[model samples]
Target chain A: MTSTATSGTTSPEPRGPRSPGRPRSERAEKAIIEATLELLGEHGYAALAIEAIAAKAGVGKTTIYRRWPNKEELVLDALAATSVPLGELPGTSLRDDLIACVEYVRRSRGSRSTRLFPLMMLEGLNNPRLRERYETVVLEPRREVLRGVLRRGIEAGELPPDFDVDLGVALIVGPILYLTKVWNVPDDQLPDDVAARIVDSVLDGIRARR
Target chain B: MTSTATSGTTSPEPRGPRSPGRPRSERAEKAIIEATLELLGEHGYAALAIEAIAAKAGVGKTTIYRRWPNKEELVLDALAATSVPLGELPGTSLRDDLIACVEYVRRSRGSRSTRLFPLMMLEGLNNPRLRERYETVVLEPRREVLRGVLRRGIEAGELPPDFDVDLGVALIVGPILYLTKVWNVPDDQLPDDVAARIVDSVLDGIRARR
Candidate 1:
């Protein structure tokens, strides 16, 4: 479905660059997205309204509606602007790759990741459109990146022969999600050995017998 | 300021028992509390209105307001009904306690605990009044139940010497919260060994280096 030819030929989203003009005022766009995130942090996702965002951005609600259809869609666009692109990592071990993943979460969301993310999560629970956008755009993209590194590990005989790469990925990172988002103690709240503690359990079976 | 004492010294409220008349209907009180939980489960704390609950229960809103002042207070009462009373285990090892804990989660919230509980957690996140009520009514009660077992385990040398009991609780239950509230996966979708995996990790550690 994604395969397409550029320009004159049929393309779903036009793979090649379009002939552009000034490109929608990058500074204004950035400011609007930043305002949306800040509001999500302070007021939470449910309380957020487009009228409030437009007011905070010093733009009209019409301007926001002109750009994005509704609050969830606007949140999608705003989130897209701020999230890490989940691209490549080093050819190093799985440890390094996982480190990069946690580091990405830290850098992208900053200290507020633990605080603001639950709002998005809880909102996703309530809103179908937001949930779709969250799963597709926000979550899958990151999962895909980690899956690539795991796939490489499988071929190289680094991971166990029957290791479920996907579950392994989840196992490695799942603690971070649970600790930060649920408990609110956060990964950052732990002593320095927390990451190492996590790595231990995932690699070795936790059974005292094992 | 919970000293609205009736005959009991521990009266946290003027919920003064058995007003000297036709003995306030036990049937009415049970039906009201049940209706409140049902509404809370169906429509969450914010959407739950006193008028609606009273109408549903075939009682006056004054009856409800007489028992509880506001939605927040009523929700707290409703939460108390839903939360499992703790210290029901066989008094064995930490594993037994944990298994009991997981079982308690199931009994308290049913198999769908994760989905239903998010409403409470998210509301607590946003509402400070709810936070105090939450800790007083739910979190602390449960923790206190487990605390005795953990102390016994420490004496008997089951859990590690340095184990953080509160953090341990969070870690053990954290993934359930993540999968339910953040990942929005159905509770029946829980991986089979999930509880075991978390328990093992806690009793041991996750780190390969450690």
Candidate 2:
């Protein structure tokens, strides 16, 4: 269910000409990504500097720049690491799939990475570069995964063929977002049952009225 | 439908012994509130300071401290100023009422004051004081207005007596917030028709399925 290419490819790779030196250090790359998320979670995007990320990652500044051309690119990759690929959910029906999706958010709502979402939204408000990267890197990819679920549901005859996919998607995802972000509902309380209710409610609208 | 009396009173007034020579200045009070909102919009709550607000308002620090005693109270008041009292929306049916409610958000979404919501959400995450004050001053009051509308809908036989009011509210408001804030869709593009669509979809599930 996860969109695979959505994460890594969107960043504008200003990767400078590679020097004929030691092969790219995967270990160093991993450290850098982890440190970037940690710092982003702690201080948000504006306060984040590549120099600080290099220090935290214990990699040289040159190595950091070699991989990601800018801070936006670096943060994009870091956020990508934190997100689960929307792989196929273990569900026989759209209702189950929807519950799985909501459960995924519920599980992650407490983590430092998830907590960074509010700050990410804050940073995106003022920074156009970060906002574009965020759409490509974070927002669009997640939306794509959900899009797939809805498309499949329609194909499987679980939903009406003529349903407005855009509005349907909003109806499905909107309340969960409201609960998590606006109401600040606790992670434990965002039950699978509520996800089921939302799915039923959305389906009632778009389902063929018998 | 806006909640009243949710602002102003929540703050603990550590009003120090007043100097008998001068009554509190209403002009200073107004300036302080305005300055707090301006700075909150520009720098966000994390960067906002009482000292900066006092300087911006051209009032003494003690004047601010006298009424609110802390930044949270000042911010709550500033946020309160931005929200309009829930005026009686002219509508007959529950669907009409719901549409009117959504239209209110649509109208205000582009304002400088409403734009502060994302920033306020970000600040509330780290600061419990602000979060509580926000709930009291901003979120709860707005919610109460919607609650009344929903209750009236139920009583009027427009919706099921046992309708999940909370979930219904979220469903109604969520997509609007998602569209306005998350997607940052253009103001002119957010049509009045959307309100009707959301109401129709919500009514489908909760309305007596005929």
Candidate 3:
């Protein structure tokens, strides 16, 4: 079955710029990722099988192996694709940038990928390899983006020079995550002004000054 | 096997007030709960079985069924036992109470039951029954504790009378959870003063007083 698909990739089809169709390899990769995510959501990390993913993707095991060396890498790529990119942060004030970051989290609450996140983390408790890859590939990159914004805030004198960047990132992202992930609050119930409210509250503090 | 265990319970043993030994039913109940927790940590909620738990506890399925109607209830009771009780809060100031709450979370980070929390929540995502039971039994009770603290603060004018109790709870608990649960930060690296710092920061705010 693998050989059949491998042969198909190398078939003597017309190879020219005029061919409007997408490259077969790219198509196959997309299918593999889509199938991996679908299977992951349905069965979770422990029960997912490579053969099942390959069969569901209508590709060959050889094709999958040729692209990704293992299931973890495949799962990583699929998850990475689903993470909502922070995109270009507006070179505005720290409040705006922080609000943007919280907004990103709020938007992510509605995605299918966000739903699978807890499951992946749950599996990570028992599977160290997957956890490490997820941290480096998915978590670290997102955290770095937020960290950069905080660093800029310090540079611009928007935040105190002695600010704790790591805690700051956690403060900005944590409440929203707790709401969406742990509480599993529905999108409708989550206030539209929550991002602004969190940013303002974290900035001004919650105490009632005398 | 169940019949034997059930019969053992009703055997013509002398009901003497002078009996020094613990009651037979109480001993069986304790063993059953212990076995349930052990299995939950090892196999997760999905794979846990009543028969396996009974066998491991040296009790019969009948004995378990007589105490708890189903696995969810049994699991809830087992989990409730493991949760660290927040006994007798220091009724000094809101800062102290909030810090104590955060400290409770920090201390809980080290327990075996805390490790199983994510796995149970992950399973809860797919199992509505489990999710509902967990919300009512575990999460809601804890949240109520925090909310009560926030409510008292509001009433005392430490916070504005219109303070959002729910969001306040999220802000206080969110960052530490992000560190322990999401980032999987090690206990050794978690600073001793973190609870105080988080509580103080949330109360004082993070923005530079420009």
Candidate 4:
């Protein structure tokens, strides 16, 4: 299938000499990203091939090449496309809001992510460009959202004015990540009330109150 | 050079007929495990070769084959040998005890661990035996220590009777693991007071007290 990039009405008409091919289309971009994720799950980083990605995507090899120089770049872009925005959670309290964020991560992480996320983390260590992009595009955005929530809570006097927001965020989210990745706890086996439990434990530490 | 595992006074005299050559020596076993860790640091899991490990350790390939069925098993054993026993920390308070544990991990994880930990985690996912040994030998032992500390804290009335000990342990250790591995944050860059701050954050949450 020869997928072509179609220019939407918002795209300005070509002012200069255009490439002798169809305009780029959002449909093809989404297809390529989805294909990259599927291939990553099945084959991992070492075996992922551009030709296979193009074939699975149902687009010409040139379509992928024009956008990404190599499989690493392609994979980075594919992951970035899946990054969720965490700005609009609806909850009556900080505890509920935190749970909402955890659920969002749970729901958004596809099966492919279960197998592929670790590979990307390992691969990113050796490759500087990939590491930077993984942090900036994939990690930092989600962290910023958490920060935003904490800041809001502090301002509303829901939290202490001197609260260490950064550490607060880490305490809230870190255990879930550790259990999932390090301990290899399957999602189903994870405690049903993990989010609530984490919030409670962190909010009121094991230390006895006066 | 070919090495052998020799029986010592510690080993009971062989009841059955033994091989003609010298018994497997404990010295050669230690050498081989050390070599495996060094190679893992330099080449990671995919490129690690049993032959190279044998050569580096100055033992015969047969020596490695006799003990471990494959590279993964050998690597797992090498890591297991390095797991620290956390039983003797001399801290006056639960907070001090937790920090000591954190410091012990920070000190014990060598450069090899920094390079090799992620590879082991990624490889362990597909290999169930390695994963099981990883949990039993490497992960669970450390987790058990944290459990012991929390239990001790509760017994002394340092913490509330109803405190969630399991979640408390996770909250204590999870952020450090997450920052080090997932974010790939350099050890030097981690705050010196991380343990104290985590302890504080969990004890008295960011939430403003009534």
TM-score of each: 0.70, 0.84, 0.86, 0.79
The residue pairs in collision within model 1 are: A200-B206, A200-B207, A200-B208, A201-B206, A201-B207
lDDT of 1 by residue, A20-76 (tens): 553654455566778888888666677788778888888766555544556766676
lDDT of 3 by residue, A83-196 (tens): 777788776788899899999988887676777787777788789888988888878889998999989988987777877788888788999999988887887887789888
- In candidate 1 chain A, what residue range of length 10 has the lowest lDDT sum? A1-10
Tell me the spans in candidate 1 whose CA falls farther than 4 Å from its real position.
A1-24, A31-72, A83-93, A96-129, A145-158, A186-189, A204-210, B1-25, B34-71, B84-93, B103-116, B144-150, B187-189, B201-210
- Using TM-score, give the best candidate's number: 3
lDDT values of the candidates?
A: 0.60, 0.74, 0.79, 0.69
Question: How far does residue A50 in candidate 4 sit from its true spot (Å)?
Answer: 3.1
lDDT of 2 by residue, B16-96 (tens): 333454445667877998999989877777788989999999987876776675787778877877675557977677777
**Docking category of candidate 4:** acceptable
lDDT of 4 by residue, A45-78 (tens): 6678989989988998876766666676678767
Arranged by TM-score with the best first, the candidates are 3, 2, 4, 1
In model 1, how large is the Cα lDDT of residue B96? Answer: 78
lDDT of 3 at A134: 89
Q: Write the per-residue lDDT of candidate 2 for residues A131-186, one digit (tens) a residue.
A: 77777877777777777788898899887787666677677777888888788877
Q: Candidates' DockQ values?
A: 0.31, 0.49, 0.44, 0.38
- Candidate 4, superposed: residue stretches over 4 Å from native: A1-24, A83-87, A106-110, A205-210, B1-27, B38-49, B83-87, B107-110, B205-210
lDDT of 4 by residue, B101-126 (tens): 76666555544554566777767766
Ranking by lDDT: 3, 2, 4, 1
